[model samples]
Target: MRVSVVICTCGRASILPDTLDTLTVQTQPAHEVIIVATQPSDIPDLTRYTAKMPLRVEFAEKGLPKQRNHALNILSDQCDIVFFIDDDYMPSADALEQLSRAFAALRYAAGMNGTLLADGIHSRGIDASDARSMLRNRPAVGPVPIAIKRNLVGLYGCNMAYRTDAISDTRFDEALPLYGWQEDVDFASRVNGEMVQVNTVSGVHCGTKLGRESSGEMLGYSQVANPIYLSGKGHIPPVFLLKLTMKNILANHLKQLCPEDWIDRAGRARGNRAALKDWIRGRVSPDRLTHVRPSPSGPKP
Candidate 1:
């Protein structure tokens, strides 16, 4: 099956090099590499990426959903399978091949997310050498068919693939804008075919800390607002959304009590409170988060 890898980047030039470097080593090279940047300036320098694979760069407005949607539209009638991966991730040598094979075998599955091999998504000091070493001792991933249950949400926008023909009318909902928290769940929910999580299709999410990170306020607000919005639309169960909402709220509050360097507890807590307040006032949605202006030196949009 012909496979195309889609990446939507928001100017993470620092980590993008490592990401592209790792892709060159894939056992089965991608048929095409489509990059959607928020603006022309956001596109990374391709001079370093000398591979012969066809590379396509396009521009989109400033939002994850919009950027991803733009790329999908461009490749509407192309490729058998489209795999989406984050800019800060490094795929194993066999990751693309494994995904292709899984799609060939799981004929009934419409979309799928890959198993995340262990690696620091935010680890500092990682270079091309470090990424090469990490792929050395990959754990054996067994063949497992994806099954559907009400709570079984499978397709993650990051590290997920879908048969080009199977995702008929489904598009990433632009309503869930910006960093697009829970955008994956919202889009996957609308898909008519079964979504699965596969073991063979796996990669390392090199969560690099040197790039633009989501502000606590943005994340916190989305945590409260996105789920509630999705639930109201029947994409998520209220109880499940409640679990997700409360869990983050409690975690932020707990961390506030026992401050951690790694977590922005107070900021996220503020976002959660803001969302709840907005919800009560009859204004709750992903757009609310977009309207919020970031503090100077805060998370970039």
Candidate 2:
């Protein structure tokens, strides 16, 4: 199967190279690598990356889901399998090889899940050599992909691959914009066939704040509102929505009361309050953030 990797990034210029570098060592090299760069300037000279397979970089209009949609439109006809991994996550050396194997094994699967972002040397920050050390010590997975339960929502947005044929004619919903809260669930739920978990296809999400926008107010609102919106559409279960909203609300409130530097608890609490107030007034909607102004730090709209 022709396999491709798509990475959408915004304001993460300094750390993007390291993410790209990790792809360079994939045991089963991708047929192509597509970059949907929200900030064209954030991307360094493409001429420097000769080791990666056929690389294509395009400047995107706006929003993470939109950027991903742009790439999927282009690659859907050209590739059999498409892998979506975040710009902040560094792939293991055998990541693509494992992904290929997983898909090849799951003959009827529409998509497969890759591992979530683990805190790998997050303090030292993301860099080329750090990725090398990360590969050396990355966890190992057995040969087979594990089947994800049917009732479970779906794949992780940070790392996952889809078989183009299995997805039928469905696409990522554009309603979930920018950071696209709960986008993974909305997108993958439309696809038919097996959704398996392949631990071998792993990556380290170097959670660095460098160049990225500080998401507080918008994120908090989305945390409460996005899931509810998806639930209304039958994309998310009310149970998940309930747990997600309550957990984030509690986290935000506790953080606000205690004042922690780790998370923007106070900002999010205020946002939640604002959203809840609007929700109480029957003004809550997924598109409520349509007019949110992108900060100077990241995600230009």
Candidate 3:
């Protein structure tokens, strides 16, 4: 039952210590803590925690998925599961324990699981702003767990777990330009297993802290390109996919209204441009995309 915790971070040094503190208190302390960091100077004083517990920190000189792939690839053979945590998130004390329990239950049941992200939180001004996360805010009355034996629309990588065996050849696709979409879901579906949605446990996702460019935030352009790629792969139904693409375009346009800065405005414009171009091309020049390569083995986690 050894689990390897991978945290992919780039330059968010201040908040990382807090996340590490939370990790130390997990009911099931991870066998190894691997930091796939990009910014070299941001590495913390390891002696503080390492003297008391097992911890290993490493760096990657690439984007999110590439770093994740590198980190996942280097995990020792003894690791039975891989737990992914984004840099900006802090898990509850029982997060790792809950994930281990969920995976154990999945193995016993001969199935897989889909993770539920804490899309909203009362602390730190976190709240769900879109329909995609409308269901994450209910009171945690009890440990409500449910079985969903279907293809997940997507996997929330911020707080997701994967079995070593199930993900034998799985890795996040580094080729995808934006980290915003499709890749995780693509990999999960190709893994060919049952995925359940677990609501019994949750974590705290501190949204967009310190204005860092997490894959989740950047590549907003993926909001448009992703649907096209998915549709080309025939993984997503056309009508629904069309609706989602349109919605993302509208959302990006709306976001353009409240540009945090010039860079944000530029990003929004790029996203909106991608959306409009794809949509218009879908109608007037459907065959114009004959040269774009289809996704290979689909999206990577």
lDDT, candidates in the order shown: 0.75, 0.74, 0.60
Q: What TM-score would each prediction reach against the true structure?
A: 0.89, 0.89, 0.74
Better of 1 and 2 by lDDT: 1
Give the candidates in order of TM-score, highest first.
1, 2, 3
Q: Write the candidate numbers in order of decreasing lDDT.
A: 1, 2, 3
Across 1-301, the per-residue lDDT of candidate 2 in tens digits comes to 7789899888777777877877777788888999998777868766767655689988777788889888987875788889888887888888888877877776877788777546532243455566567668766678786554433467777787898887657878888767888888778877876676766677777766665446567777787778777888886568877898899888889867765454566667766776787789888876686544423342211
Most accurate candidate by TM-score: 1
Candidate 1 least-lDDT 10 residues: 145-154
**Which is better, 2 or 3, measured by TM-score?**
2
How far is 184's C-alpha from truth in model 3 (Å)? Answer: 2.2
Candidate 1 collision pairs: 121-206, 121-207, 121-208, 122-207
Compose the digit string of candidate 1's lDDT tens values, residues 1-301: 8899999888686667777776777789888888888776666678767555678888889788898888888888789988889887778888888888888888887788877665553334345566667677777766653332223564666687889898766788899877788888777778777888777766777655554545777778888998888888886667877888899889888878875555566778878888999999998887888665444554321
Clashes of each: 4, 0, 2
Q: Give the winner by lDDT.
A: 1
